[model samples]
Target: MKRILIILQKEFIQIFRNKTILPIIFVLPIVQLLILANAATQEMKSIRLAIVDSDHSPESRSLINAFSHSKFYTHIPVEGGVNVSIEQIDFGKADAVILIPKGFGEYLIEGTPVNVQLMLNAINITSAALTHSYTSGIIQNFASSIGMETINVTSSKPSIRHWYNPELNYKLYMVPGILVVLVTIVGMFLTAINIVREKELGTIEQVNVTPIKPYQFIVGKLVPFWIIALIELSFGLIIAKIVFNLTIVGSIPLLFGFAALYLIVALGLGLILSTSASNQQQVMFMVFFFMIVFLMLSGLFTPTESMPQWAVLFNKINPLYYFMKVNRMLILKGSEFSNLWDSFVAISIIALLTIFVAIKRYHKSV
Candidate 1:
């Protein structure tokens, strides 16, 4: 224990003494939290709504006015042609295009079903879905106001409610995922880069020649980084609350406990990769490879259910997949331990396996 403490002190000194790493460790995570938490949002703001009004009638104008008055959309002026509206979409000046057909006023006056065309940029499916939904609601509401009764198959009108996040704020979903990203960066990149730096500087040989056992050396290196990563998580959470109004509705202890375990898994991977690789570039390349691949499969921005069956099966082996799930579940849903047992078990098993592999693979090149 005393030897490990001495090594821990040495690592901290080395970390603080380095100018480049000091700012990265102490400053970078907070900035990422502030920027990325807002940037990764799923909500659409001020959707550009384009109108190709060939109708040129009171009803067409009224429908356009309803859309203009709605908070979710911004009307973009376009010339009179469906092709013109498509041009607006192509030029990135509009998100959705509304075609007020020539017969729209006649259809409305005859109490016939008026068919208005809506075209959307469906590149981002979530944004498109929302834009479609908001616009459809405005059209429906306007129709209802003008006494256009529609027939339904069922008498039951369901009042759908969004629990946990009533406002459907995207930041609430993204902040936790972004927090996972920050923690992963601290635990994986810094640990890997720090250890590889020592190797490159020829300082690792001095420590390796000592009588210190592998576990002692590995623990010494990991303990300091582990604490620093937790500190990073804390700072990120604080910023999340202050800037995004994010609330942790679940047990804080549970979230932290899972974080501690997940950090072990992340650090172990970095430590092993550092020990295996010969240089910083190798370490960084490997980090980018794993980070992108794991994050893509981790269901951060997209749902894993939407993936192919084999891809979903592969994610079961991914540590970030488990951690991301648990964090969102605990923070947003206020889920209990019972609900998260499967993920907790998977993380623990991965942590133990990664730690064992990392410790076993580390060498002083004896």
Candidate 2:
């Protein structure tokens, strides 16, 4: 324990003495949180709308007026007709085009059914989906205001209650996710790079020649970083609360407690990668591969349920997947400790497996 403390002291000095490392560890994460927390959103506003009406009647004008009045749309100018509007969409000037068919006002006047065509740019699926939903909703409200009779007499309107996120703010979801990613960046990349830098500088041989055991050396290397990451997380939580109005409904201690275990696995993985590589560049390429794969499979931006069965099975071993899931549940839903027992158990197993392998792989002679 004494030897480990000495090593820990040396590591902290090395980290803080370097001016570049300090900012990378602390500043970058906050910047990313501020930027990405706001940027990665499911909400769509100020849709670029184009209307091409063939009838040009009062009903058609009323439909166009409805779109113009709504907060979701901004109508852009079109020189020609529907073809011109379609060209605007193709040229990236419009997001949606509403084509009011001929005789639309006549059908409405004669009490007959009429249909309007809606065309949307589906390149961004979420934006497209929201635009369609909002546009359809406005159209339906207009139709109802005009006293259009519904065909279904028995259909009942269902009330929807969005629990935990009533305003559906996207930042609430992204802040926690970004926090997890920041911890991962600091823990994994720093551990791997620090050790590998020592190896490249030929300083590792000096340490290996000393009386330090592999387990002791590994613990000494990881413990300081574990504490530093926790401090970073606390700082991030405070920033999130101030900037995005984030709330932690679940136990803060539980979240950090699980994070400590999760960092064990992350740091161990970094150590194993560092031991395998001859230089920092090789370690970087390897880290990049693993990190990209982990981020994509972690259900951060996408829903894991929508994935195929094979991909879902593959994510069972992914540490980020479990961490992301648990963090969101704790922060958003205020899930209890009992509800997250499986995640805690899974991270424990992962920590044990990875740390065991890292220790066994680490040699005394470097």
Candidate 3:
């Protein structure tokens, strides 16, 4: 225990002495949190829409107004007909084109079926799909407002409510996930390069000849980073609350408790990589490769349930997946430990496995 504390003190001294590492430890995560939370979003705010109104009637005008007034769309006026609007899309001037047919108002007044043509640029399938859904909802709302019985469905209406995120703010969903990613990067990458850096500096040989055991050495290496990562998580949460107005519905202590365990999984993975790697460069490349794979499979950007059956099965070994899911559950949903016992158990198992592997692989020799 005394040897471990001494090594921990030495590691802290070394970390603080490095000017470059200080910025990476403290500054970089903050910058990444701010940028990624805002930029990496699925929500589209400025969808350019071209309108072709052949009818020029009050009803047609009202329908056009609905889209124009929406916050999601930017109206692009075309001089000619539907073909001209298509040209606008071809020229990259518009994302979608809405054509109000010549007898749209007449059909609506006569209680007959009216057809409004909506053409979207399918270059980006996801964006196109969202635009289609948004436009369809607007058209339906417009029809209902003007009392178009033919367009109105059966009288039964579904009471739709968004539970966790009532306003559907993208940042609310993204910030917690981004926080997990930031913490993972710090814990994993720093620990991965720790022993390798010592090896490079001719310090590992000196330490290997000392009386320190492998477990003590590993604990010494792991604890400093574990503490630093928790501090990073705290600062990240504060930034999320201040910049994005993120509300934590769960216990802060619970979030930190899970974070403490999750950091072990990450730090142990790093230590395992460090033990196997001959140099810092090799460890960095390995860390980068695993980081990308873990992030993709972790359900950070997309739903894990939507992944292939093989991917879902493989994600069982992914530490990021467990923590990402748990972080959001605790922070956004206010879930108790009882609700997240399975994830906690999975992370605990992974932490133990990684520590065991790291210890076994580390050789106490020059």
Candidate 4:
């Protein structure tokens, strides 16, 4: 215990002494949190729409007016009709084109079915899909107002309510995931890099020759980073609350408790990487490779449910996936520990596996 504390003290001294690591530890995560929470969003706004109205009738004019009044669309005029609108789409000037064919007003007057063609630039699939949905909603609402029955509806209109996030603010969704990323980076990357750096400088040899056991050494290496990562999480949550106006619906102590266990999984993984790698470069590359895979599979931007069956199955082993789910559930939904027992058990198992591997992999050699 005393030896472990001494090593822990030594690790802290070394971390604080490094000039570059201080910025990475304290500054970079904060900057990324502030920038990414705002920048990384799925919300679509200001869609450029081109309307080709061949009819020149009041009904066509009203349809165009409906799109123009929407906050999501900006109407671009095409003088040469559908051909010009297609050209605009090809030139990247328009996201979607609404072709209001001739006799559109006549068909509506005759109470006949009228078809309005919608052409979308599918270069960006997500944008095109969102544009299609937005424009379709506007057209349906316009048709309803003009007493045009596009579809014979026997069912009542559904009362839609968005729970957890009533406003659907993207930041509220992104901040918790980003916070997990930052904490993971600190716990995993820093631990691996610091240990590999010691290996490069021949410091590990000196430590190995000492009276420290392998488990003690691994525990010593793990504790400092574990504490630092928790501190990082605390600071990140504070920033989330103050800057993003994020509200924590769950218990802060419960969040911290989960974070403490999650950090063990991350830090132990780092320890394993550090034990296997001989240099900082090797460990850094490994960290990057793992980080990319973990982030993609973690459902940070997209839900894991939307992924393929194979991906969903493989995500069971991903520690990030469990923590990401747990973080959002706790912070956004106010989920209790009882509600997250499976995640807790999964993370605990991963923590034990990683620590055991890290201890076994670290060789105490002169």
How much does candidate 1 score in TM-score?
0.80
For residues 1-366, what per-residue lDDT tens digits would candidate 1 score against the true structure? 899999999888988898887688767877887788778777877999998889799988999999889777888998667887898889888999988788777778788876677888988888887777666666776777888743111211332345787656888988899899999998899889888988999888998898888899999989888999899988888888888888898989999999999999999999988987879999999987999999999999998899999889988889999889999998899999999989999999999999999988987666
Reference-based TM-score, model 3: 0.85
Scored against the true structure, residue 46 in model 2 reaches a CA lDDT of 87
Local distance difference test, candidate 2: 0.85
Off by over 4 Å in 4: 34-42, 52-66, 78-87, 99-117, 138-173, 249-251, 301-303, 306-309, 332-339
1-366: candidate 4 lDDT, tens digit per residue: 998999989989988998888777788667988999889976678889998999999988998999889888888989986788999989999998888889888888898877788888998898776666666667777878988775221121332345898545678999999999999999999899888988999988888888789999888889999999999998898889999888899988988988998999999988888878888888999988988998999999888999999989889989999989999999999998899989989988988898888888888862
When 2 and 3 are scored with TM-score, the better candidate is: 3
Candidate 2 colliding pairs, count? 0
Tens digits of per-residue lDDT for model 2 on 1-366? 999999999998988899898887778778989889878878777899988889989988998899889877888867678788998889999999887888888888887867778888999988886677677667776777788742111121222335787545778988888988888888888889888998999898999998889999999999987887888888888899999889998998999988999999888888899999889999999888888899998999999999999879988899999999999999899899999999999999999999999999989862
Alpha-carbon deviation at 65 in model 4, angstroms: 4.8
lDDT of each: 0.85, 0.85, 0.87, 0.86
Better of 1 and 2 by TM-score: 1
Q: TM-score order of candidates, best first?
A: 3, 1, 4, 2
lDDT of 3 at 144: 75
Each prediction's TM-score versus the true structure: 0.80, 0.79, 0.85, 0.79
Q: Where does model 3 exceed 4 Å of error?
A: 54-57, 102-115, 143-172, 332-339
RMSD of each: 4.6, 4.7, 3.6, 4.4
